[model samples]
Structures are given as structure tokens and as C-alpha cells.
Target chain A: MNPTYFLLLIYIIVCTLIITYWAAKHSGTTKQYYIASGTLTGYQNGMAISGDFISAASFLGVVGMIALRGYDGFLYSIGFLVSYNVVLFLVSEPVHRLGKFSLGDVVCSRFPGQKMRLIMAICTFIISLLYMIPQLVASGFLLRLLLDLNYSVSVLLIGTIMTIYVVVGGMIATSWVQIIKTVLLMSGTFLLTLIVLSNFNWDLTLFLNKVEEGTPLGEQFFLPGHLFNIPIEFLSLQLSLVLGTAGLPHILMRLFTVRNTYEVRKSLISATWIIGLFYFMTLILGFGTVALLGYEALIAKDPTGNLAAPLLAKVVGGDFLLAFVSAVAFTTIVAVVSGLAISATIAFSHDIFFHILKKGKTTEREQVRSARITAFIIGLLSTLFALRLESINVTSLVSMTFTVAASSVFPVLVLTIYWKRFTSVGAITAIVSGILASFIFVVLGPYVMNPSDGLFKTEAIFSLYNPGIVTIPIGFLGGILGSLLSKRIKQKETDFNSFYIKAQSGYSSRGES
Target chain B: MEEKLLNYIYRKRKRLFIILIFALLFYFFLPLSLIFIPEIMNKPSFLFNLPWAWVYAILQFPMTWLFCSIYHRKAKKDEQELDAIKGEDVN
Candidate 1:
């Protein structure tokens, strides 16, 4: 590794550590560790949520896809942005006001239980672990490209650093870093778009005309073969993107960070604008990649298309832009992983350990410690999994994780919010059913598995596979089934009303405002 | 008789929830069959460089809201009944 590249890596670590320590100093309460003490407003929290939600996979993956396949890549962006509307109208206030921490808190707040809480936390952990794997894998992949080093070394290194950041800092570090990460992600995308658009001779129509002249699509900037290319398997891919995004757990967790229902609605609108604008820019960036870099250059330089946007930067803006894009990519991964680590830790420490083991009386200091420690433990496990399973596409796997979230968390959450009769029994059943169905589909479903070449081989169950449409209904059905069986089913209307108020007015000031 | 159903829908949430779900299912399987059907689901739209599948993906929200709005207006009306049940509205 060149001394400068190494220096840049060191710079990121040191800066992150400083930010972590600063956040740690102020975050001295249990509330602080869990929901940032409910102090963060919707706008700030919205950006942090976006930063957390976007992740490396989105930051890197979508750009790469658009460059490779035309308009299909924008589909991910649309799914991600559009889902929040469902969140705002559906879940914002209920989730925010009902919980101290953990999604289980929201689900179990009205219903009495160690049983439901424990079960949901267990579900959260499994789903979170599944979610974290791709982040670690992406870290490894990114490091390999950045330093020209082996992937495993990068994974271990990123896993360790992320663990330390989450363990020491708590939610404060997670939110702040997420903020910085969002800035970097947005700025990097913006700058790259500018440089690429500059080279397009200012005519998208003309530019696409040239691309279509050469490629199968007959029009390069736009999707070919009927406005947007209808792949033979388009139906499956569509289900995955649309339904999968609706139910993601980590993304859902972001809504709870805000202070009120109205803010949640507002943030939804803002996030849509931000995400829509970003996807729109990606169109220009993707075409610019083909228009300027050309297919031959892309294949030779960035066969993975992972580096399409970056390579475009290098071509027009030179090696400095390359270095900058790479640095932003590093920040992108760190920002997201840091949030993931913090979220996992909070779910474990607050939801499983303290609230379950000692009841809700666990001191703020103790809660902080557990949260930090949990982050470390979760980070370590995810790294080990990533190291073992090397061949998975870090980005596509994220969509699967989203599918699980949409399937598992979305149903229980939405059902609880909207339906009067969603019993605890129902919540538990839904979670288990959704997870089991998705898990079975993932393992048994036919996917082209690329086994890792021997360095501790790992096999993925289903890829090019989206279980959202199938699993989300199963999740809904599970809750329905659970509710039907519960002896105390009439309590549904009471639970629903209180939960609605708690959710709508939970974090707000005293009395109905 | 039908107007009462309309009035109830415009006023109550729990009742409207059932209606919205029914509408969505209808939107998914029948009238909007072209949206989610195998053949149509395979297509993509190109406004803003989105895919044809995106036409459905992008449209699903407004469609959901369109259905929800019918119920939301009803839910608002039903909320008043909630006050009546509590005897708060009787005075």
C-alpha cells in the first residue's frame, strides 16, 4: 500500500475514534444509549436514519447496477425511497412513542411479557446478524480494492474497528458518524455526477443514442427493450425490491429515532426527496460511465462495475478524484456499519439482557456498558461469518436482508398499528413464521451458489432470490394465526388504542397536543 | 343503506382497515391485474429512467394511499364515534 492510502485509512480511524469518545462522554443515560434519549428531531434523525439505511451496499451497489444494466438499477432507489411513505403513514408515531428501545419494546409494550420480548429479541438478533454479514463482506471487498490487500485481512480489520467504535461510543457515535457518512455519500455522488455530466456533451438524448447504437439496449441512458427492459425474471425481481424494502428492521428502527408522528411524516417526505434526487442523479452518472469510460474501459478497469462511478471520477477528474471516491466509499461502509453495530448492541443489551434479565431497572451506566460490549460481540460474530462466506455479493445480499425485514418486522409492526386484534400471541407467531419461511426459502430455494475457494468455505442458500412477496404475507398470516388462537383475543382493541396514542404521542410533551 | 357504509368508512378506522385491505387485494389481483400479473409485472417504466416494473413499484404507494385515503376520511369520522362510546360527545 502506498504511504498516502495508508495515511488516509489511519485518518478515518483516528477521526472516528475522536468522534466516538466525544459521543461517549455525553451519552451517560440508558435512554441515551437506546433512542438517543429521544432528543434528536426528525430532520436530524431523518438524515441519520438515511445515513444508517443507505449503507455501503446502497452507496456502492446501486451505482454499479445502473452502469451495468440501465434503468433497472434505479429500481432499488425507488423501492428504498418509496417505502418510507408506508412507514410515515403507517408506523412513525406508534414506534417512536411506545418503546424505550428495541422493536420488541414496541410490540410488547401493550402486551405483558418476557416470553414475547425474548422471542422477538432472538428474532431481531438472527435477522440483524444476517444483515451484518453483507456489511463485513463489503468492507473486505472495499479494502481489497483500496489497499490491494487480501479480503480476509480487510474484514478482520474493519470488524475490529467498527466493534470498538460501537462499544465505546453507544448511539451517539452511531448517529454522528451516520451524519458524517450521509454527507460523504451525498457529496461523493453529487461530485461524481457533476464530473460525469460535464463529459456527456450536455445531451442525454444524444449520449444515449450513441450507447444504444452499440449495446443490446439500442438506447443506453434509458433501459432498453420496452422503456425498461422486462427481464424474463422481472416479476421476481420486482417483488423483491418493492415488498422487501417495506419490511426491513434496521430501516424501521430509524423511524423510532425521531420525536413525533408529524416529524416522522415530514422526514418521510424529505427522505423521499433526497433519495429520489440521488437516484435521478445516478441515471446521469450511469450513462456518463458508459458514454465516457465506455464498456471496454469498464470491463478492463472495473469488471465488477463496483467501481463504475469511481472510475468515471478518475477518467474526468483524474487520480485525485479516484482517491476521493475511494475515501468516500470507505466512509460509506464505516458510517453504516457503525450504525448497524450500535443498533445490534442496543437490541441485545437493552432488549435482551437488561430489560429481560434484570427487568427495566438496569442503570444507565450499566446499560451503556452492555450496549458497547454487545456491539463488540456482534461485530466479532459478523466478521467471522463474512470471513467464512466469501463469495456472496455484498450488495445483493442486502436486498435479501431487506426482504427478511419487510417480511418479518413489517407485518407485526403494521398489523399491530392498524389491526385491533393483533395479540402478543399473534406478534410472536408472525415473527416466527416469517423468519422460518424466509429461512427455509433461503436455504432450499435454487440459487446459483458460488462457493468460496477453500479459505473456510461458506455456502449461500438462495441468491437472485427475493422472498418478500411470499414471506411478508406469511408474516401477516402468522400474526393473524397467533391472534386467532390467543384466549385473550378481545384485548386487541384496547391494546390497539393505547398503542396508537403511545405511538402518536409517545415522545411528545405531556397532555394531548 | 349503502350511504351508511360510506359514512361509516368516512368516519371509522377499524372498519376502514378492513376496507383498505380489501381494496389492496382487489388492486393487486383483479382490476390492477395488469400491475402485478406475471406479464405486466415484468415490464418497467422509463419516466426518470425507472424500469417498467418500477411503474408498479412507484405506483403502488399512491395506489395504497388512494385506497387508504378513502378509509382515512372514514377513520376520521369513526374517531367521533369513539368519543360517543366514551360519553364525552353526549354532553
Candidate 2:
């Protein structure tokens, strides 16, 4: 490893240790472990939330997409930014007001049963694992590129660091790390954007022309169909991105870290501003990469263009800048993977162990202990899986998680909040059908069944790469059809009314009978 | 009085939902519409150097932020009004 790479690694390690050591005292109780005792201010929580939102996929993969595909990659950023509207307008308040620790808490609060908790816990685990795999894979790839480490060693290093972060400091440590990561990421991108613009004398049109000159497609680089050829595939990708964000278990869990609904609203707005600006800067970084290093150079460095940002750093500022960008990228993966591990751990310990198996009677100490152990297990499992699936494109795998989330979790959460008639049957059916439909579609889709490299070695039967367009409707149908067909449960209506009042009014439901 | 409060809440919810639906449709309209009018994608819209497709994609960032700001203000005002109505009932 280069000396600067060593220094960057040491800096990250020192920061990680300080954060964990500081947060360790606060994480002794279950509440602190799960939601940081609901003490974070709006800005802190917002930064943390945005930090979680802008993961390795957005920092590296999306910029890579923009570098390679131009306009199409920026379209992905727009989809991601707009999805915050779904959270702000519909999901955040209710999730904050009603949930205690996890998305399972919000869903099960209305249903009031172990079955719903169990189902939610399982879904959260699956989604969190799927989300973590891409982050781990990306980190491994990044380390291999930057430090010349073996891919397996890189994966192990990331997995171990993330597990340590969660197991020692839980949500407090995770949130602090995320806040720090977001700041570093935003500043890094902003500075890079400035440098790129300054290179072209701050003329966007001139920059565009230079970028066009650098590519074979020229003016066609600004068009949409280069990356997503089919119209439905593009539509499906957008739909997944917009809806899947609200469904993400880890993101939803962030809402529970705030004090109340009002803070949740404030946090969402703050997160939106930060994330939106960061994505806008990504456009400059992406196109700037094309202008500075050219698409051919970027593709030569990394075929997937994952190295566009860091490689651009090298072109503009040499090895020192390259080391800093690489470190920030590594921090991005660590922050996201830590967040994912904690969410999955919460699902296992809080939702399943305490609520389902132990009947919510376990001591807080035991709950925290269980969460730590679960985090370790999940970290190990995801690291092993990441090692095995080292060759898949990171962004595509990340998009699949979004598609699954949009299909399964988004529909049920929306129905539970808005529809008074939504019953346990509908929620359960939506979760099950959403998972099954998206799974089946993805298995039959091009990602899995393309003739040359696909698992089955046959022509893809499913034309669309993303299942969101089809699966979202199927999920809603499962919920609606199940609710309509089932007998009207009087208790469920009453439960809905109470939850609705609290969710809408931002009132505490604790003292209510 | 409680029934009236529920109605008020319901009406506000409906208005918010309408805004949300409209905003979402408008945001999605450009790209989805481009599918039917593929020829438009090639034409330069704003800056002569950039094509309509690029303009649409880039414009979405500002448009999304605009919608978010508008919705946030509206939602906050509605919440305050709801709180006022509840306080009136309690008094």
C-alpha cells in the first residue's frame, strides 16, 4: 500500500475508534441501542439519515453511471431525490409517531400480533442483507483498486469494522459515523465539482462541449436510451427508486430516532436539501470525469466506471487527492454497512427474539446483548456472501434491492397508514406476494437469464430488468384483495382509528388505553 | 364536534394527497412522455449545446426540490391549523 493509503486507513480507524468509544456508554440500554434514546436533534438526525441514504451506490456507482451513460445516470439521481417526497409527504410522520425501534414496530403497532412482527422481522432481515451485499462488494472492489488488497481480505475488513461499530456502539455510534461520513462526502464532492468547473473556466456549456468531444456518442451522450434501451425498463427503474426509498428498513428505522412527528418532518426536509444538493454536485463530478479523463480512460480504469470519481481525483489533484477520495468512499461503505447491520440486528433481537420468542418480557440488558450477537452473525454471513458474489455489478444489485423493497414493504406500509380497512390479512398477504412476485420476476428477468453469463444459460423470458412496475401493482392488489375478501374485524378498525389519530395529530399514544 | 374535527382532518388529508399525486405525475410526466415522442429527445431545448433529454433530466432536480419545499410549507401550515382547531375544542 502507498504511504498515503496507509495514512488514510489509519485516520479512518482512529475516527472509528473514537466514535465507538464515545458512544459505547450511551448504548448500554435497549432504547439507546435501537433509537439512540430519541435524543438526536433534527439536524443531526437529518445528516445521519442523508448519510445513510447516500451510500456507496450513490457516491461511486451512480457517478460511475453518469460518467459512462451521461444523462441516464443523472436520471437515477433524480429518481432518488424525488423519492424523499414519498417519505416527507406520506411515510415519515406516521413512522416516527407510531414506531418504537424498527419498521416492524410501526407495522406491528397497528396489527398487534407476533405473526406480523415475525413477518416484518423476516422482511427487514432479507432487505437489509440484500442492501449490505452490494455495499460490501463495492467496498471490496474499491479496496482492491485503491490498496491492491485481496478482494476477500477487503470484504472481511469491512465486515469486521461494521460489526464492531454496531456491536459496540449500536445506533448512537452508527448515527455519529454517518453524520461524519455525510459531511466528508458532501465536502469532497463539492470541492471536486468546483475543481472540475474551474478547469473549464466555470462554463457549463463549454464543459458539456468538451465532454461531448471526449466521447464517441458526442451529442447522443445527452440522450436517455443508451443505458436503459427499453421504455418499460427505464420506467420500472424510476418507479423502484421513487417508491423503494420509503420502504427501506434502515431508512424507516431512522425516523424512530427522532423525538416526534414534527422533528421527523424537519429531519426529512433537511435530509432532502443535503441529499439533493449532493446529487446535483454528482452531475458535475460525473460529467467532469468525462471531460477531464474521458469515457474511454474511465472505462479502461474500471469497466463498470466505479472508479470515475477517484480516478478523476487522480487526474485533477494527483495521489494525495486520490487517497482522500478513496478513503471517503471506504467510509461511505462502512457507514452504510453499519447502518444495515444495526437494522437487521434490531429486527432479529427486538422484533423476533424479544417480541416473538421471549414475548417482549426480556430485560433491556438481554435485548441489547442479543442485538450485539445478532449483528456479529449477520456481519459474518453478508461478508461470506460478498466474497462469493464478487463479480456482479454493484449498482444493478443495489437496484434489485430497491425493486424488492418497492414491491413488498412500500405497499403494506402505505395501506397500513392510509386505509382504515387494512387488516392483518392484507398486510401479511402484501408482504408475502410482494416478495414472491419480485423474486420470480427477477429470476426470469435479463439479469439472471441472459444467454451468455446468466445462471440458467437461456433467453430471458421476462423482458423488463426491474420488477417494480409489475410487482408494485401486484403488492397493492394483494393488500386490497385480501382486505376486501376478509371478514371485517371490528378490533382492527378501532386500532386503525387510534393509530390514525396519533399519526395525523403528532400526539403521543402512550397514555391511551 | 369530534365528527367535525374528523371531517376537517379528512379534507386536509385529501388536499395533501391530491398535491402529492399531482407532483408525482408531473415529475414522472417528462420521462414517460419522452417515450411517446422519441423525436423530441434529439432537439436542444434550453442551451443550444444540450439536448432536450439532458435538459429534462437536469431540470428534474430543481423541480423536485421546488415541490418538496412547497409541500413542506403546506403540510406545516395544515398541522398548525389542525392543532389550533383541537385547542379550540379543548377550550
Candidate 3:
């Protein structure tokens, strides 16, 4: 264990804990604890959104993928960047106006029943928990690499820190942590990119040429289909990545951190620009890893390409740069897991405990206490799961998480907001069917059923690794059909109209405007 | 007045629908073209002997920004118009 790496790691921990201490003082009320009373500016929330979205998978895995798999790796970045369009053009503003604390609030705003809230809360809990496990697993490995600690110890350490941040500081601390993470990630990646370019004397043509020569793919390095030979598989993966963000609980939760629709738009725009630029830098960094570090060297160190960024850093700037990049990756995981923990905690405490158990009559103190307890439980559960999952290939969990969100939550949220005939039955059907279809497909697909390395010694039934192309359409269909086939209740005169007006123009009849 | 507002929203949604169609098609065209028309995508561009696939992927950035800017401006204008309508209703 190098002293420099340990020092940087300790510095990040201390700084975040200090921020949490300050935030704990401010987050006395439930509103403050949940969304900082919606006080963050557009750009501030935007930075936090980026921090929440770009996890260790993108930071470490994408670089390695690009270096090894060539053009297909860049496709992942494209899918991630374009996914914001779905969020911006479709869901962001209305979600901001409708929801207060959790996704359940957004849905139950229309349906206004315990059943709807229960469904939304469960979906949020599942998605957040699924998203959190991979993050803890990644951080465990990263910490092990950084400090040579046992994997279990590292997982426990990160798990404790993330729980502390959410339980104490709440959304304020989560937001600030995410903001610092985005800044560190952007600067470290940008500096490394500039160094890579400077090493090649800042010549684009020469660098591209070197990249082509360095990789085993030769001239085919810039061509697509290196990783995905089947066109359908690629399209399926793209479908999920492009449509997944709008349904992500933690990402949608960030919308409530800003005040109004205006800031919602600003937050999305600022986030788009930041995310776009970061992906662009990653694109360059990916190719630079190939051109500078070479493909053979990268594959030999780590076959999965997760270490491409730090390995390239070490090559260019020695141990100091490697430690810095590793620390940034560590922070990426921590910020993301904190966001996930908060989302899951709110789903349980606010939606379940306060709304269901107390029937919406809980005190603010009790609600806040419940949220803290939920965060602690979620962090501990995830840490325990991560310790067991050390041997599994967790990279697939990223896309699996996306596919699940794209199928279930995406369809439910879209129809809830846009479709007038979208009833509670339809929403429930959409979410349940979406979850079932994706889970069944993934279980039957190559990830699980392969005879050689899968969990079961059997032949695969479903072939598509993503299952999004099939499952997403099934989700939408399930909602539409369920709505159409349901027994029509007598329509309320002003229900759909009032909800539509407020959803579109942020003008509710409660007379705030 | 409610009918008029609904009609206005319908028109706005129509525009959004059209833009979304075009944006999604344009975004998916890269992968589709690579699969069905690899020769064209693999050919070097005039920019720097780089493959067209690289250029195409890079262009997604500007296209996204432009589309977002267009929508932002339109949404802002729509918000002001709705506010004006609300003012009229109040009066």
C-alpha cells in the first residue's frame, strides 16, 4: 500500500464527512432531509445529476472497453449521452412538478391510492437496490487495489460511509458529494486527456494512426461490431441505454432538488452539456489508452479493461496519477451509492412508513428517523450482498439494471404522464409485466443459462443479452391493453383535465400561481 | 377556454412527437448503417483519413445540443404563453 494513495483516500473521506456534519445541521426537517427544500440551483443540481449517473462502470469499464473492443465501446458512451434526450424532452419537468419526495409521490399524484404508492415504492426500492450492489462491488475491488485491504473490509468501509452520508446529511450532503465528485472526475479525466495528447505532440492524425497500430484489430479498430457481432444485440443494448435514464429512481429524484420547471430544464440542459463533454473526453481517453498504453499491455494487466484508465495514468504520470485516477473512481462509486441509498430510503420511509404505515399522519421527526434507519439497513444489506458477489462478473448488472428500468418504470412513467386513458390498473400492469419480462428474459438468456459458465448447467432459451428491445415494447403493450380492457368507471369531470393542465404548464388549481 | 388550451397542448405535443421521431431515427441510423452498410461507414472521411463511423459518432454531440436548444427555446416560449393565458383567466 502506497502512502500517497492512502493519504488521498483519507482526504476524500474527511472532506465528505465534514460536509455531512454541516448538512446534518441543516436537514432537521423532513423536507430539508429529502430534497434540501428544493434550494439547489440548476447548474448545481445538474452537476449532482452527473455525479449520480456516471458510476465506476463508466469511468473504468468504458475506457477499457474502448481500448480493447474498439468502436463498440464508444457506442456505450453514445447511448448514455443520448438517454438524456428521453429524460429532457419527455419526463423531467412534469416529474419535477408532480413528485415531492419519491417516485411514489409522482405516480400517486394521479392515481391517489395506497396501491399505486405501494407499487411505485416497491419498484423504486428494487431498482435502487439492484443499482447499488454493483457500485459496492466495484468499490470493494477498487479499495482492495488501492489499500490492499480485504474485499469484505473494503465493502464494509464504503457501505458505512455511504450510509452515514445519507442518514446524517440527507439530500444536501448527497448533492454536495455528487457535485464534488463531478468536478474531480471531470478535471482528472481532462488533465489525463491533455497529457495523452501532449505526449503525441497534439497531433490528431498521428494519434489515430498510432491507435490503429497499437490495437490488434488494426484498421478495423475504428469500425463497429468488434464487441457485438449481431446487429440485434447492439440495437437491444442501445434501446435500453437510450431509454433507461428517465426511469432511474436516483436520477429522477434529482429533479426535486431544484425549485421549478424552469430550473428543471436548466438542470437537464446543464447536465446534458456536462455529460456530453465527459463522454467526449472518455472517447479520447479510450483511444489514448490504446495509442499510449497499447492493447496487448492493457489486456495482460486486466482482461476486462477496467484498469485501462489507471494503467494509462501510471504509464504517463507514474504512481501519483494512478492513485489520483483510482481515488476519483472511488469517489464516483461512493457518490452514486449514496444517491441510490437515499432514493431507496425515501421509498421506504416516506412512501411506505409515512404514507402506508402511518396513513400519511406521521410526524416529521419520525419520518426523518425512519429514513435514517432505512438508509442504514439498505447500506448494510448491499455490503453483505457485495461480499458474496465478489466472484461474479458484475459488468452485466449495469445493463441489466438499465434494461429493468427501461422496461418497467419507463413505460409506467410515460403513460402516467402522457396517456389520458392510463389508469391505475394499467400502471400496475405495465410495471409488473415489464419487470417480469425482463427478469425472465435475462434469466433464460446467455447470462444465466449457458452450460459452461452460467449459474445453471443448461442451454440458453432467450438469446438476446439485453432483452430491452423485446421487453420495453411488451411493457408499453401491457399498459395499453390493460387500460383498454379494464372495466370503465364513470369518468370524473375535472380529474384528467386538472392533472393534465398542471402536468403541462405547472398550474395547479391550488392557487399558488 | 379549456378546449383551446387542450388544442394548444395537442399542437405542442405534435411538434414534440415529430422531433422525437427524427432524433431517434437519426441516432439509430449510425448503428443501422454500420450493420447494413458497413462499406460506407468504414470508408475514410475527407476530414483526416478517419472512418466515417468515428465522425458520425462525434457528430451526435452537436446534434443533441442543437435539438435540446431548439426544445428549450420553444418550451420557454410556451411557458410564457401559458402564463399569459392564466393572466387572462384570472382577469
The number of the candidate with the highest lDDT is 3
**C-alpha TM-score for every candidate:** 0.82, 0.96, 0.98
TM-score of 3: 0.98
TM-score for the first chain in candidate 2 comes to 0.97
Any idea what lDDT model 3 has? Answer: 0.89
True contacts kept of each: 0.04, 0.56, 0.54
The DockQ-based order of candidates, best leading, equals 3, 2, 1
Q: Looking at candidate 1, what is the lDDT of residue A56?
A: 65
Candidate 3, after superposition: displacement of residue B28 in Å? Answer: 1.2
- All candidates: interface RMSD: 7.9, 1.7, 1.0
Error at A238, model 1, angstroms: 3.3
lDDT tens readout by residue for model 3, A345-458 = 999999999999999897889888888888888888888998899876575677788998999999998998899888888888999999999889988898888889888778
Q: What is the C-alpha RMSD of each candidate to the true structure, in Å?
A: 5.7, 1.8, 1.4
lDDT of 1 by residue, A134-158 (tens): 8888788877876687998988887
Q: Which consecutive 10 residues in model 1 chain A have the weakest lDDT in total?
A: A504-513
lDDT of 3 by residue, B1-91 (tens): 5776777688878888887787889899988988899999989898687779889988998898888888889898988888788887789
On TM-score, the candidate that comes out on top is 3
Question: Any runs in candidate 1 off by more than 4 Å, and if so which?
Answer: A2-4, A213-216, A220-233, A392-396, A448-464, A488-496, A504-513, B1-91
- Candidate 2 lDDT over residue span A1-513, tens digit each: 999988988898798879898999889999999999999988899999988989887898888899888877788888888899888888888787778888888887788888888999999999999889988988897899977899999999999899889989999999999999999999989888888899999887799889898887887888767787788888888899899999999999999888876678778888988998999888889888888899888888799888899999999989998898988988888999998999999999998999989997988888889988998899889989999999875655776789879988999999998998788899989999998998899889888898888777899999888889999999999999888878565544345666777667654345331
